[model samples]
Target: MCGIVGAVAQRNITPILIEGLLRLEYRGYDSAGVAVLAEGNGIQRVRAVGKVIELQNALQATPATGHLGIAHTRWATHGKPAEHNAHPHMSGKLAIVHNGIIENHSPLRKKLIELGYQFTSETDTEVVAHLIAHYYSESHDLLDAFRTALGELHGAYALALMHEDQPETLYCARMGSPLVIGQGSDEHYIGSDPLALLQVTDRFRYLEEGDHARLTINTCEIWDRDNLSVDRPLTRYEHAAHSLEKGEYRHYMLKEIFEQPQAIRDTLAGIVGDDHVLTAILGPDAETRLVDIANIHIVACGTSYHAGLVARYWIEDQAGIPCTVEVASEYRYRTVVVPDNTLLITISQSGETADTLAALRFAKDQGYLATLAICNVAGSSLVREADWRLLTHAGPEIGVASTKAFTTQLVALLWLTTALAQVRGKPADQIAANVKALKDLPAIIEQALTLEPRITTLAERFANKHHALFLGRGTHYPIAMEGALKLKEISYIHAEAYAAGELKHGPLALVDEDMPVVSVAPSDALLEKLKSNLEEVRARGGQLITFACETIDQTNDSNHEIINLPFVEGCISPILYTIPLQLLSYHVALVKGTDVDKPRNLAKSVTVE
Candidate 1:
């Protein structure tokens, strides 16, 4: 998860590059750097170990102004977060910024070392700069050298390179990672995201896998993986800058949390029609695909994986089709026994998650019925490559800790469940009833948002908590997992989630007076079973914090605290309960004085493995 921004223009690109880097701050980074073709000279670069402001301050002190440049905000991989490992790594006249990992860098670094190349940083990216520079030494053509260098590299990458000799041109390439070219009058740009280049250009072109381009101020020359020149479509893209602003909220996390009501409404708007679920929103082949579906193989990472886990319960309970959910990172390594007519589903907010995208590719050949990408970004590699795509309208999830994306995904999955159930012989009225329930979800979640003040007070107790245990039953188990993930991600608490039944087997041992045990007590079939597990935590003298339904008769005692939420029907309970957990994490992070929007050691869109 790194960011890349490049520009080839006749004007001062310094301010533009710095602002682009600032726009990419949401993606998360430990080190930042910029490489520019110096004013009437060779290449110049500035790198900083901390925030982008440090790089900005460094630039203000000693500017590297040029018309052609590439900037990067790196989320460390292959090396620690340090100025030495920062991007804009150089080799003589060539300066390069890269996002994604180079798997064969170890061997490449060794080979380059023997060829009279001296390494300065312990980064795999430095090898790319040296490799390109090595080839440039022989060919004297920068594009030819870049293509040759790309051919030698293994694994995913989105690279932007600049040559001192080619002052007016910017070289960029994408292989299993996202890269976009911005079209402008007498100027062009390349960025990992369209949002970063919005100030300069409205029209953008997305590069597919193995596509490379040479960009001049007025021209964008492209080539496919076969060294064939190709032209990618240029389409106008527009986003209001104020839409990204936090406004009244202190952090993007808080903004997105409140945005969930509208976000879910938007996600369902395309699919939920008058008393019926619109199956066509999924794709032309969705109904036909569901007809033969005997199983589902859901693969994703992080919060998306947890979303899949929740969908597993829905698919089985509603459609009567067995579903298995696995973390995308581990799915490819194991020998997967895919059943006949098994549908492979991959979920991601950005749709550019490296492991999930790679797993989707691997699953394509494993004899699945079809692959569907439930993604947010329409231009993401996963959406472009998948057989069928369901776009989640979460807008832009700028916060590293996802809120709206997760709920919007749940909404998408619920609609998908209805579509699947329809073809699988579920009652039409029952399906319609479930879809009808979704229409009220926005209001229900809005009511849940009203419980934030209670959550804020509950979160104060967690400011001193270093460890937390989250427990849930049935579909809520995944909700528990997601809540734990949020708490750990933002609040920096050591949080773990276990199925309520599994608590006594091992986790109950960790429960004590100092330990906080949190649970979402939904009024479902498992409520009685979940209460027994809660008793186990209470027996262990743990601090019990329950986000229970208003219908449940509960009182706060010395050892326990209960925040009653607006009761909802069983079908949409998970979505409703999720809000309080999010608020809990946010308020807890605020109390702990932690960075709520941009968390440490994490990136919003995990674009690399």
Candidate 2:
């Protein structure tokens, strides 16, 4: 989940490499470093221990100019976040920046030590530079040395290598993680993402597995590991400039969270026109198969898995389908039977989640339909392998902890459910009513953002609390679990979500007056049961703050605090319920004086599996 960038040009390359690192900051920010090949001198390296801005300030303090350079913003996968553990690691005449884990580095490190190689940092990336230096010492050509060094390495990586001997060129290679080459008139660039090169050029080349590129001022030469020449692939792009803009918010997370209103509008734009409500859901063969499905297997990882859990409730209640939600990491190992007419659906933000991709392949091998992926990225592996696909219009989620992507997944799954119900001969009136309610959801979510202040105030009380419990039932059970995940992920708090009914089975014993219980008590068919569950917590001396549609004034309750919400249908409750929880986790982390943007031990993308 680190960021990688390199540029080869006749002119000085410091500015371009810096800008590219800024654009790729979302992928990583724990540490940053840059290496430039100076004209007369050897490779010059600079590194810092904070964000890219920190590195920028350091560069201003002591800057270097060169025609060839490589840079990285590290995410701390292999070692601690130390200045020495930062990227642009150098060994003798070579300097390199790398992404992904070297799974066999411990053994490889011992082997290198035996071969008389010394190390200055606790990182897997350093091993590569040392090995290349070892190879370059024996072999004359640096490009062949890089290929040979890579062949000896194990695990996934995207590497950018620069050396004093090869001052005019920058060498790059990719295995599991993403790396792309951008085409410009006078220069060719390699970066972790398109945004890094969007301002430089619209023309690009997609790097393939076992592919390596040697870039220069006016040309790019691609090759396989065996040194066989390869051709550059065609370009692909997005709304590059608009995406680069921060728009109106302070942080990208807040901006994306607020953009949900418009995002939801865009998602529902064509679903209801002059004629039909679920028209957008009708794909080529999707309607026919969905109507006749005997069961649905929803596979995803992390945040996407929470969305799948919500869909499990929706599809089963509305479309009369039995649904199973499985974690993609564990799905392949279990020997499960696929019933006839079963629909296997995979959900991913990038559509490149390694385990999810493997799970889709496993399902395909079992002779089920390839798969259907609900993904944001258009050309990702899961999307390409799927038999059918639904594209989520959430744009780009730069933040590691998801905000808009989860909401749009729920929206799309609901629409898909409504369409399938109609095809299954459900009353047209019921489907129309659900669509109308969904159309009104964006405004309700806008109103929900107003709860930020109250959530902030509540966050103060829980900042010192080391442990917490979240509770919900029915459609919102998954939301409670997701809320717990956000807090634990970003706030570093120990949190757990129980199915409300399960609290007394064992978890209730952990509750005391000091421990807070956050409850998602949205009105539903199971509301009475959930209300009873809340009363049990109150009886056991648990401090309670709840998100609910029921009135605090009407309840006459003196012990517990309630955050009242606008009345929305049970199916739509999770959408609105998520806002306050997100704000709660955000403010709690702020109050605890923890890093809210990039939490410790977590990366934006889990590319290495």
Candidate 3:
């Protein structure tokens, strides 16, 4: 994952570029850099190996002012995280910042080296700059040189390039990665995501794949892959700046964990009413298609993949449709049969996940009945490409470890499950009861947040542990996986999740006093079996921290700890149960003094393979 921002303004844009990089920090980056086309200095570039603050300080020591500039925050892929490998790489006449991998960079680098192009960095991006510069030497036209260089390259990229000769212009292009142009009065902005431009302007144009653009103070011109100029629709994005702020919370992760109640409420608003469940977002033929679907294929990666696993249980049990969940990266490489009348569903928070997008495109090439995306971003690539789209409305999740996004995804899946059940001629009373339960989820989530103080205390017991195991049964198994993922992501603990029934198969052997077993125990049909599983953990001398419903009588045991959770109806229990685990991870990370928002070696958005 990486971030790129470019600007062309009538006034100095160094401050804007730096601020944009600061906002893009949440995307996760190892190095920061900026290149500016100054009046007399030509293209002045500065880079730092650590944080954006380092880059800011570097710029202060050797200041550069310009009206046209580009900046980047890189999460290293092709090279080590160092000043030499940082972005805005220069090649005599051109400076470029890129946000994706070039698959053929090795061959191209070899060719360029043979042609007497000297390399200074171990990055695939450096080749692009040199290639463009080589083309410009012959063509003498910036756009044509860029176009020819792009034609010769292979792989995913979102590039921002500036030429020393053309100090007032910025050229940008995107293939697989995300890029957008923010329109402002007498100024124009380009960024990998809208967060970079939220403080500057809300009116922006999202570039489609294989699109290139030239930005100037007075004009913004977009060109298609075929070298024809294209008009991209400008949308007025209404995301408030305050939504990205931490407010009173110490970190965005904690604020997001507490924001789950409102996030789920916004996700379910108008879709679930007291008397009916709206299926209109699935398109006009949702009713007939839902009932006729033969199989359901859910594809996602990371936390979104765990959410899909949870939805598989709900879809099969409630809608009577056979469901299969697959990790997107693995699913794309394998030859899988896509049966007719099968619905393919994708889940993502940013909707820009590269693997998931590739899997969705692979499914599209096959003969699936329809495509549906349950995502947070409204106009993201996943939403725009799918036949049906449902926005989670979780707002901006800034933390590298997801909390609100995963819960809101479960909310959307639960709604989809009920909609399918209703279309399948399930009893009206049953559907209405589920809809009523859905309406009360916000209150239930609020009740769950009340347990945070107690969970924070419980987290002290886990803060020093080297490893942990999470256990759950039936539908809650996926919730266990997500809880384990959250704990390991933020706290740096080696955590693993096992279905309660699968513990004896292998994972139970790792249980000991040093390894705590955290169990997500809801009062469902599998409660008795889950209790039995907990007893096995207790017998193995594994310290226990169980999240159980209040009515469960397991608290009387003196050997184990029990954190009471709010009792909720039906499949909504998983969504409610996720809050305490999130708090546990946050508090544990806080206790360990780790970076709760930007975890090491992880990025919020995985835009590259």
Candidate 4:
């Protein structure tokens, strides 16, 4: 999980490269560096140990002017976060910035050492620079050198290379990681994501797997796996400018939290209409294929995996389908049984999550009936590789601790469940009722946002607690897990979640007055049983913070605090309940004085294994 950007422009491109790196800092911030091919000098490089601002300050002290440059903000996969391991690794004739892991670097390093090459950094990226330099020494062609270096490399990577001999051109390659080429009037840009290039141009071309490109000032030439020239169509993204701004909010995380209403509405716009009618967005043949599906296998990672867990409940309850949710990293490494007519569904916010992408490819090889990707990005690898796709219109989620992306993914999963239910011959009235409940989500979420003041006060109680426990049951059990994840992610607190009933088995022993217990007590059939579980916690003198619907009875006990949420009918409780939990984590992180947006030791996207 790192950010890489390269630009070839007619004018000096140092500022553009720096700005792009600043925008992409959320992806990674352990270390930062930039390599430029100066007009007179062969190559000038600047590196820093932490943050883009450090790199910016270093650049100010020693300025480097160039028409072409490549920059990187690293997440420290191969080495510790240090200046020596920072990216834009240089090797005399060539410099490179790389994202993703080089699994074969150890063997390659041994071979390079045998050839009398010396390394200055502990990063696998340095091996790439030296390899490219060695290849360029042979052919003297930058493009051929890149191709040769790529052939010798193993594992996922998105690389941008610049040669001292070819100062006006940039060579790039992608395999299993994201790389996009932005088209501009007098310049061309390469970035890990489209947001990095939005300041310069909204038009971009997404490079497919095993694609290499050579970019000049105004032209870009793409080569496929066979080394044959290919043309990638340009797409003009409309909302890039607006999505990049924080608007009136103080932080991008808060702005994104408030944007959930619009995000959910945008995701639902074309799929649902008046009178609770559902239109088809999954293509015309989806209904036919869905009806024949016997099972659903959902593979995802992190927050996306929690969303999949919630979807399992919905799909099984609503559509009567046997659904299995697996962590993508675990699923790819194991032998899974795929029965006939099984549907493989992959969920990811970036769609470039390495494990999820690998899991999807594995499922493709198993001959599934159809593959579906529920993701936010339009042209990401998951979307392109899958046979069916649904987009979560959450825009750019800059926060390392995900907020809007998880909620919007829940919304998308709900839609998928409802659609599958209808295709499987569920009653028309029942489907309409579910649609109506879905329609009320935006307003319900808006009401949930108003609970910030209440959640903030709750946060004050949580600030001092070193450990906490979250409890929920039934469909909302996964929501409890998500809440715990959010709390630990931003607040740096130790938190664990359990399915309430399991508390008596082991987690109950950890509950005490000092250990705060947060319970998700929605007004559902399980609410009564959940009340008994709360009593179990209270018996142990544990402090309780409960989120319940307005209809639920308020506890008179002083040790317990109750948060009355807005009444939401049907199975949409998970979506509405997530808002206050997010606010709670945000406020708790604020109280604890931790970095809310970029949490320590975490990256926004997990593009590497």
**If scored against the real structure, what TM-score would every candidate get?**
0.62, 0.60, 0.62, 0.62
Quality of model 1 by C-alpha lDDT: 0.86
For model 1, the stretches where C-alpha displacement exceeds 4 angstroms are: 1-242
* Model 2 vs. true fold: TM: 0.60
Q: In angstroms, what RMSD does candidate 4 have relative to the true structure?
A: 16.5
Error of 3 at 262 (Å): 1.1
TM-score for predicted model 3 compared with the true structure: 0.62
Supply candidate 3's per-residue lDDT for 112: 97
lDDT of 4: 0.86
RMSD per model, one decimal: 16.6, 18.4, 16.7, 16.5
How do the residues 1-609 of candidate 1 rate in per-residue lDDT, one tens digit apiece? 478999989888988898898887765567899988886767888999988899999998878988999999986655677889998999998899987667678899999999999999988899999999999999998888999999998766889999888889899998756789998889999998887998888899989778999999898899999999898998887344338787777888998999898777656643554455655444434567678889999999999999999999999999999999999999988899999999899999998898999999999889998889998876678886887777676878899999999999999999888888887778878887897789889998988899888888888898788999999999999999999999999999999999999986899889999999999998888888888889888987999999998888779999989888877777789988899999999999999999888899999888888
Q: What is the C-alpha lDDT of each candidate?
A: 0.86, 0.80, 0.86, 0.86
Off by over 4 Å in 3: 1-242, 556-558
Per model, state how many residue pairs clash.
0, 0, 0, 0
TM-score of 4: 0.62
In angstroms, how far off is 441's CA in candidate 3?
A: 0.6
lDDT of 1 at 344: 93
Better of 2 and 3 by TM-score: 3
Tens-digit lDDT track for model 4 on 469-575?
99999988999999999999999999999999999999999999999999888899988999999999999999999999999877647899999898887589998
